[model samples]
Target chain A: MTADFDAIVVGSGMSGGWAAKELAERGLKTLVIERGRHIEHGTDYTDFKAPWELPNLDAVPEREQVHYGGRVIAASTAHFRIKEDDHPYSVAEGKPFRWFRGYHLGGRSLMWARQSYRMSEMDFEANKKDGHGNDWPIRYADLAPWYDHVERFAGISGQAEGLPQLPDGQFQPPMELNCVEEIFRDRLHETFPTRRLTIGRCAHLTAPTAEQQALGRGPCQSRSLCSRGCSYGAYFSSLSATLPAARKTGNLTIVTDEIGHSVVYDVATGKASGVRVVDAITREHRVYTGRIIFLCASAIGSAHIMLNSRSERFPTGIANSSDMLGRNLMDHVSGLGAGGYMPGYTDQYYKGRRPNGFYIPRFRNVTEDADFVRGYGFQGGASRGDWRRGGGQAGIGAALKQDLRKPGGWSVWLAGFGEMLPNPDNRVTLHPTKVDKWGIPLLHIDCAYGKNDLKMARQANRDAVEMLQAAGFQGVNERKAEPDEPGRAIHEMGTVGMGRDPGTSVLNGFNQAHDVPNLFVTDGACMASTACQNPSLTYMAISARAAHYAAEFLKEGKI
Target chain B: MSISRYSGFSRRQLLSGGARIAGGIAVGGGLAACADSAGQEASDGLAARLDTLTTRDALRRPGHFFSIAQFRLLERISDLIMPETDTPGALAAGVPQLIDRMMVTWALPETRSDWLAGLAAIDARARREHGVAFARLEPDTQFDVLSRHDGEALSASDRAYRQMKSTIVEAYYCSEPGATEELRYDPVPGPYRGCVPFDEIGRTWAT
Candidate 1:
């Protein structure tokens, strides 16, 4: 029997959106399932709200504070964030994993911190060199073209520093670095020759091409209210870019409010047939059949679905022949950094609130070797304290008001994001008894930073302090705040990772399941190693590449 | 920045006003509600003028968390904390009303009582120092009494006092007249200028 559709892409987020766009563009009829309410771009965004127009100073009300678990969510974008009480998950008693999520039509794409970076050849070889996780089946050479393809369509704004560890991509005009950043960059080069500071490579349009402009995307306004959602279509989100492009292809059918429960295995055919979905609101189950299935439902989400896809042939889960379906969970080691106060430059101020920050690319384990296996990169900027700083200091009347008129002393902060080794112990499994309201098994996540990860974090903290102090910054204090939890970086990846051998991994070089030929896991789940760079750009490239091969495979009748 | 942008709130909403604090219903043109209610011209400071209007609103509007006397004391405190400078201060910016609205809808029960106790403490200090309530004291005397209280409370690191002061400062700055007039706020800054002289912008950004 013919399939209901040529292809089905699960989870309309960063990777799924790209898969949908590529599949639909290749003339394959694609169905995109989103597990949240449909959001109309621009209409749904609260970017137009002025300071005076914001309710209760954009603070989440005290009554509803219980839902957020002490995290201060801005009231303007509170709708994007799911209530923790409603969407339940289990973590190990000692270990804590902060699954910061947005379950809307565009998923976390709508609220992602748009920092985009590409993993280098060195990153692809790290696992193999150190014998951490399985070696990536494919390398930087295989993904370079796909990176160019996605970057052209998605519009990454960055400066090319010609560094090998951090490869440069097709980019628009890079956002300018402020005076202090420029000074710091020059000073750092003088002090530490290997270290380099450049503007953050973000998935935001600095110069919109005719293709992007035609799809209603424009240049960024630099308003710095991205968390609230950008109405201008300046920042690339699935809703703003891919879904629209997919729709324009006339081969895309998207259904919101349908959660992907599991992959339906056809035991007779020995290939995956379709996906089983649960209606989020109605709690009704339905099967959507297609010739091919692409699982782009994030790292943990895709793992959850794969772990639950139980069948007679694969009782552990569908495509779990290797028993490596839900293991080697990884997230970037975060919450280790330093900040300092800059004494001078009170006269220098920036006009717009630049959404992007300065990026100090990874120097350790590249130009200089570290005691640990891998290294980290620092992301931060310098700016004067605004009126909010007045609240903490000793001040009162007209004099306080007068002092607040001009911005206060310039202070800089450097937040380190260290690479995490793929440990088999840090994994996600289905809860034995506990299930969510939808009767779907809850994900019991047990993830923590390994010894090397902790060592790298401490070294990163020292590097930040040294850099700041070297740049003549005073009051150089290291950050020691609590809740330095894993997964707090929101760069979770691995589980169902790609490898050369079928016994060791779930997916192959093409991001296609080794056991199930017609099934593809192209999201963060396909990552063999967690490179220090933000994983979204690599995920986009991988998704697009996988979709390309999947389309070719269908045309060639390989499956 | 204009009051004309504040059309979401009706005349009744301007009086029965706690909904806008937490409901997030202010779509467009809803900033005028606060300015619309500030018509009573009185001598002394902006507090004395706001006292007449807020007392009436608090008495009639059931949404108001603070009582008439408590509301009046809050108005006096906020006004003194941020008096009418070159730009509109706390009273004209409706900081007291916003705080009262927050107490009803946004504050926890403990937080609300803590604010009430703080306001009562200020009044008691005024009565102990002088011979009248905080609101009844002369403008100069009110400033003296509040300044001493502010210094002591801030030095002691009083949570309630700090919360109230910060809220007032934030509210005033976020107000239309305060934000656009007192500080710079470009909603759609076309391009980023990395470095410019402070005099070029003249004021801090009130984002």
Candidate 2:
């Protein structure tokens, strides 16, 4: 029972927004389904409020605090609450995956770490170059145009210094580094020939272009409290950027809370008829029919749907001939780094909010000092110690209060994001007995890395500590991060990867399932390899490219 | 899952008011008894809910239950941390509420014991050292007390208590209100002027 619409896109997060915008802009009738509730773009940003304005005095319950705090004095901004009682996924006993996710219409885009970076030729060619899991079906040249397309509309604030491994994008004026960071950058570069540090290329609007102003977005307020959702439309989230553009095209129909349960596969035609979804709130099951389907419900989420789509022709799962539907999961192994007091900057401070920090982009086993097959990058910063700097001391009374008024010493902190090589052993499967609230089988994730991930993590941490000590910061030390587990970084990717060889992989160059031409998976599930950089930007570009291609293909009757 | 919708607040508010202060509301009459019975009642309308408090807050009930005068003392303490300078300060940012909620969780049994012990011992130390209770001591004496032996290694519980107090105070003032008001918070400052002269903007950034 094929429906009338030209295409259907599931999930409205990073990729979904791109799909919707691209399809609708091309005048295709597109139905966008979001598992979470709808969010009115400009209207709902709680971060813009004062502390007194929030309920519970901005306090998370004591019981809830210990579980959520990231151990850096509780900076796990409150949105990490995905009700454990309502939606439960099964894990092996003693294995805890702290999936810091918010299931909203915009998904993680609502709470994205908006450090936008394009995965260069080195990243795409890495798999084939090293004889790894699978070669990416597409390359940097194929995606460069789309990256430019997305970045231009998204308004990435950065300075382009045309390096091959780290390609430049359409960028706005970059945010400046503080005095301490500037000095650190110069010193580090002078000390080491290969090492280079630059201001983190972020999504916050430094200077909103005329294109942005036309979208009703104003310049960034620089309050730097962007994690709570940007009220100024300053950062690029689907709610703030893409969806709004899609809505203007007059061909986009959005249906929220319609969680895509499984795709309806037509064995005869080798095409997806539509999808079966259940109301995330009402528990009412419904079916949506469209000529083509684009699954963008995140990495693990899309895998769950694909694995659940059982048909007579494909019992293992829809398009699961390769038996690689839920394998090779990868998230950036993160939180291993160190920092210390920079004694000299006691008298200085900066003004306004610099939402981002210095990003020490991938300087790992790349060329000369080759330790591993893959690489990693560092996104960190230096700042003057604020009032909370008096921690680990006993102070009270008027005297204590008075001393607190003075700013403390300056300090530098560097946190690294290391690459986790894709391995078939690191996989997610369906838990037999457990079922979530919506009767969906719970995802049993059994993922772990090999020597490659470990070597990278250890090196990344040591380098940070050595760098700090070398920079003359006292008490320079390495943070022994909690053990690695899936969903920790929430940047889950590569469950059903894209590859040139359809004989070994599921999706193709255009993110279309090889077995089913009309079925497209444009989410993190389509990633062939998880590059060290944040994957959301790549997902957006790829989704837009695929959606635009799919619409054109449909118009040309290619499928 | 979608029952909750985010209330619209601005970056301006976030920069001006510190986040993460605990608050409890005796809504729907169920918690009315808990409210009145749990807290300490002073002559002033303000109340210090010690029974439920979990840690040693730097800014003690000076008061939190509902004593208007004691609450005023808290307001004054907050203001002192965040002086009017060019912008407003802690008092303008609702830091009293932030402290109140922090105290609720921070005043755990292990931590509270240290607080009661510390206060009693401090006064005793004052009496033994100089023959006067700490509260009655001169402002100079109090400053000396706070500064003395600040570098000493504290017991585990004592360290936790110290951490709580510093966190409460630091969090309150360092927040949007503490930084933006007491100093300055320009959320929508169109272009970032990297090396602006001090005289141009005047106040320093709190963060």
Candidate 3:
């Protein structure tokens, strides 16, 4: 059967945006489906609003506050996040999993922290050496060019630290570390020669290039209001960068508020023929056919769609010949760190509200052996305390006001992101009876951190306190406990991972489905292992690389 | 540092009104519709009808969850916590209104009850000490009652007092006068300077 479009990308987020742009620019009639409402670029953003201007002073409404205890929904970007009750997902008994999601046109790209870091050769080879998860078919060298390509377009601001485990990427001028941070960095490095702390590699244009400027994007003003959506297009987001490029190609069509239900497979062709979508507002079911399909609808979303896609040949699900489709779920073990005061930096203060922070690249298990197999990295910053500190103090009235007018003592804290080993037991499946408001079967996520993850977290916390104490910091405090639940990091990956063997993986080296050609899953779902660094940058590179390959294959009539 | 980026209420314009004490809607440009008819009883009738009783309602009304007497006490206590010095303080910044709105819209019902109970406890102390309500008591007496309550709250780890105080402090600082005049506010702070002398920028940043 002739498809309605040349290609269909079921998402418009971090990876979907790249796929749409690459496919559309290559002259394919691409249709992008978003489960959330459409948002115009500059017009939709409320980034210019001050604290007083925001509703309830940017607090969540009381009725909805219970659902937003995670601090994901602020009044500024409440529209971007999903209500927990409205979109329900169950977890396995005795296992707690938090599925933090933003399901709008740009998905999480609009509300992401924008921390961009490249996974190194060690990350790709980790699974092969350790036997924790399936071996990655591709290496850092394969995706390095794509990382360079995406970094150039995304305008990643980063300092080039010559670290092997954490590879340096093509970057704009890096945002500078503050006075206390600089001191901490020097002292820490001097004490421990193996460890390095550099400025965070973030997707904010410190200096916009001519191409970025032509796209109506400007340099970051350092407003530190990025989660509210940057009207200046200073930070990388689907609405800011990729979607505009895709629109410019004149081969893109967007259908928002359409939840992807399942992939329709043709028995004769043995390929996915179309996708069934349920209208989010009207509850109407519709099918949109395409020659090729890209499932960049997040890690779990894509897995759910694939798992629900039942067929006569593949009775379990479409392209699930190996039964490894919803297996090997992983998210970075996070929320373990230390904080302390840097006493001497009282005289020094910073100017702008720099969005990016200092990054302590993974040191453990890279140079020296750890109690755990994998390592963790720290993302942290140093800043002088503000007026809020006065709340704890015993003063009030004129004297209190005078004291608060002067900035309080300098404090520093580091948040660790540790790698989680991929276990098939930590899986996502369709709930038998329970369904969401849209009638889609609720996904039952059953994921928990293993012993290695806990050990790594503990070590990371201990190391953070040790580093702070070594740097002459006072009153060092460490969170000895690990994250109570999985998915708190929001870096979920490895459900439909890319690997060498079709029997054990869903996607191949190029992010093409092993069982079904002309089908790609190039988001976090394609990751074989959850690297200690942020995964969005890696997802961007993989999506771009896959789209390029898919386009070439289409031109050559390979499918 | 560019304060002009935050458009709506300027420090001078707010000060000129001399503590009219309108809620959240009085500050930003977007809420001009509500701010225009803020003081008029006739306009307030329409505003009241439109009020959804959400967290945002506190922006439009003097109180949401609190009764008239409770709200008056809240305003007085907030002012005492942060009195107007050279700059605008809690009362001028509409901290009580923020609390009233937050209690209804932001707080859980249990949290709201706890806050009310805490307020009643302070009033009880005032009545025992000076034979009047906390708001009607003399300034020094009110301060003494609050000081004792504050000490008890700190020692006992009272969640209600902490919540009320934090809300008041946050609301005060985020207000125009408190942000721009008392502390330094830079809406667009381009090119961060890592190390600047304390004398270069005297006040703390209002972010």
Candidates' chain A TM-scores: 0.99, 0.95, 0.98
Model 3 spans with C-alpha error above 4 angstroms: A69-72, B1-65, B104-108
Model 3 achieves a DockQ score of 0.52
Interface RMSD of each: 1.6, 5.0, 1.4
DockQ of 1: 0.54
* Top lDDT hit: 1
lDDT of 3 by residue, B69-168 (tens): 5556777778888888777777767677567555544665555666666676777777777776676778887887887788778668777687677777
**Real interface contacts reproduced by model 1, as a fraction:** 0.79
- State the lDDT at A294 in candidate 2: 92
Candidate 1 ranges with C-alpha deviation above 4 Å: A481-483, B1-61
Q: What is the C-alpha RMSD of each candidate to the true structure, in Å?
A: 5.6, 7.4, 6.0
Per-residue lDDT of candidate 3, residues A140-216 (tens digit): 99999999999999999999988999888888998888888998999988999999999999999989999899899
Candidate order by lDDT, highest to lowest? 1, 3, 2
Estimate TM-scores for all models. 0.93, 0.84, 0.92
- lDDT, candidate 1, equals 0.85
Q: Put down candidate 2 lDDT per residue, B51-102, tens digits, no spaces.
A: 2222222232222332222233344334443434444344444555555444
In model 3, state the lDDT of residue A268: 81
Off by over 4 Å in 2: A1-4, A55-57, A63-80, A93-96, A394-406, A481-484, B1-98, B101-160, B171-190, B193-204
User: lDDT per residue, candidate 1, A179-232, as tens digits?
Assistant: 888888889999999899999999989999999999999999989888888888
